[model samples]
Target chain A: MEVAYLGPIGSFSYRAVKLAFPDAKLTPVATLVDVIEAYEEGRVDLALVPIENSIEGPVNLTIDQLFHQSSAHVVAEIVLPIVQNLLVVDAKRAPEKIFSHPQALAQTREYLSEHFPQASSVPVASTALAAEIVQQHPTLAYAAVANLDAADFYGLVPLAKGIQDVAQNNTRFWVLGEKQPHIALPSTAQKVTLALTLPENLPGALHKAISTFAWRGIDMTKIESRPLKTVLGQYFFIIDLVSNDNIKYACKEMESLGITVRNLGKYCIYEGEK
Target chain B: MEVAYLGPIGSFSYRAVKLAFPDAKLTPVATLVDVIEAYEEGRVDLALVPIENSIEGPVNLTIDQLFHQSSAHVVAEIVLPIVQNLLVVDAKRAPEKIFSHPQALAQTREYLSEHFPQASSVPVASTALAAEIVQQHPTLAYAAVANLDAADFYGLVPLAKGIQDVAQNNTRFWVLGEKQPHIALPSTAQKVTLALTLPENLPGALHKAISTFAWRGIDMTKIESRPLKTVLGQYFFIIDLVSNDNIKYACKEMESLGITVRNLGKYCIYEGEK
Candidate 1:
């Protein structure tokens, strides 16, 4: 299968796509939209996108795209451990400035504060791009927080390692495609993803809709709403159910109560076990 | 009232906070965590943090912080339109590169792709900081996408104005405080907020919980869920309802169904007219 992932070949998302489908032909895109567009345009059989990071929470871009594009299904899921290092152009630089992706910088704020007391840190769009900037600048006084692969690609030397506040940092990626992969056991799988919205503004309408799930003992894994963008008050919801069958029933019940329901498909169960 | 906001002054969050609390004392912090910490330490009576943007969706850092710190209440909400401008130190300087906050850069990707095809765009943590970078590196042919206030502060001229692809781009900020504000309404308000979690490994539990709200005819304004972090599959939801009474009733019903209900407080209706 041909797979599309975000990158310049060394990005974490690229690694994730490879890890999940090792033998698949890979295509790299610069943005999430490109990846989705590639999938929608039939350029790739499947696309891998980062959905959430353990430290950063959900990636809104991916979620928004998933909601907007109705054709793709979340076919598989993968969680990859993230390790960031502060790489520099020279060992004796005593870097006066550091650059990294905003999320990476946020994750390593405490470490940077404590260790690089006088250094000014700036955010970049991506860790790999930050490394590329440091290399192109010809400044030994700058460092970048990125993965080892990014450092190698940009010809930077590791200045410090394991800078993230949480040592167990991990990012979760979802594989999206037109066809849903068949899971071995549908009963054993524990999570179901659904997208829905309520009818026009009516007093006490949302409380009544959610009660259907709560009343039936369906555990919601996730529930996020975005404005319909057409009307001021209308909003749409993306919810995840603990059981696939439970979700089917819940969707039926929700529709009966005038709440529109759309199942986005499911992936491997997160058993909550390490 | 004294309010704390994230910024170096002239930042989007700062403007949003000022717009929300016109007569209040606004304290600017470099980070959102500082804004939350100030409120937690009682240094500020309230805090305003950006929660989501129309183009970008939710601000995961602020949302994750809300989940991380359970004591704060979201007392009010405000949505402000965002217009990004490309500012440069010298108009004559050939724009070889551009810099901006990641969000700003992402929001203006189409503009950059069309207008500055050859320019390399760099992302920073804040627009104000990006403006500062341009000022410091005046000899370099660089520009930044920032608000007019930031351009004026850094003495940069606007190379281009309102470059964002989405004209309806807006950001929503949550006014957080130790206690919910008691705003007496001339008419009954139409918004309520709640936090909830379902029982462990329970099938169809979430569906049952939400069904109560649906049955009560309450319209949901917003609904979002975050992983508990402590457990992989466990999640907690942050929901907004049309009426406090309806949400209260739905909570009672959910609790009876064995769902853990946490009331994060409610606020007056947000019509977005202001």
Candidate 2:
């Protein structure tokens, strides 16, 4: 199997991909768009992308592209507890510039403000990319907020560990593939993901749509609303429901109400070590 | 009146603030957190912040800081049609780098990928800051994705205009203050924004909460799920409802179902010229 992920290598997505597909050949791409493109263009068997973080909410780029630009199905999920660390080439030197992916920068905002109040923070494409930049600019007083894996991979020193604002900073990554798994899914399979587009200007369309599963005793783990990208007030709901035999019936009932339901995937979730 | 906004000036938020309070004394701040802090600490009479965008959905930093850190109420809103432009110090020079706020960068991602595939895009604190950086470094081949206001403010040439991915790229900015408007709101006051926290692990809690307003014929203009920041799969719904007399009753009914609803504010909306 071949797997593609957003990376310069040593990113959280790379870690998740490694844990999920230990034997697969890994292809690291530069951006989330590239990761999806690699899967869509048949360059890789699967693509792993971060969908949400406990601290930052949903990754809008991934959600927007997943629903609007691609038709791939999510085959698996990995929940990784993110522990951001400050990496540097020379730990003794006080850094004047800090860098990381925007989300990582946000996760460590409080720490940065409290400690390095005068340092300038820069956002990059990925945390590992920040590490690479910091590694290459050894003479500059620069630091990166990334995972320990990045520090190890780039031979940078971890000046500080677990600098995220919150203690439970978990990020969820989805492995996207071209086809669904067989009907006899593993017993661990517990969640079904659906993207629902409700008809416009309807008062109770969203309520009615959720009721279909609610009335059936199905538990919804999450419900996120993203813009349909057409207008300001218009949105489509991305829902995560406990996998059940009655999901199809609920989807059918929703369809009858003029709600366009797209089954993105039904897959099991695995927890990654912190 | 004194107003604080996220700016070095010439930002979209600055434009919205100028339109909303043309006569007020404006105080430009560096970050969204500083804007809220200025309001909370009584440094400004009102603080203007970007709440949501048509293409990017909700502004997570603003939402999180508003609900979690402060108790201010949203007093008014301004919807501005965003038209991103490529700003350059030298129009004849081919740009090797692009810079903008992360939101602006994402908004113009498609345009950048199509027009300048080889240019490196840098994310900055604000679009105005990007224009400032580009202005100060005339020797470097750098461009900024910002509004016409920014380009004019920084004396930069507009290499391209209306370069956003979508035409309907509107952003909603909220003016937050300490007190409720004297109870006699204007006729244009049409929206009430609420943040609701549903009790843990309860099936249909969200459905039940929405149904309170839905069954009463109240139209919810928007519903966005944001992380509660406590754990994975937990969320708080930020709901925008069309202002109505029955909204209080709906809140009572939701409270009866054990939902914790925080009334952020009920405010009128204004539109800025494109």
Note the DockQ of each predicted structure: 0.42, 0.39
Give, for candidate 2 chain B, the lowest lDDT window spanning 10 residues.
B180-189
Clashes of 2: 0
Q: What is each candidate's fraction of native interface contacts (fnat)?
A: 0.56, 0.29
Docking class of 2: acceptable
Estimate the TM-score of every prediction. Answer: 0.81, 0.88
When candidate 1 is compared with the true two-chain complex, its DockQ is: 0.42
Tell me how far the alpha carbon of residue B207 in candidate 1 is from the true structure, in angstroms, after superposition: 3.7
lDDT of 1 by residue, B75-194 (tens): 877766688999998887768888886567777999998988999977565688888989999898989888887887889999989998767656777788866654322223646777
Residue B33 CA displacement from its true place in model 2, Å: 2.7
Q: Name every residue pair that clashes in candidate 2.
A: none
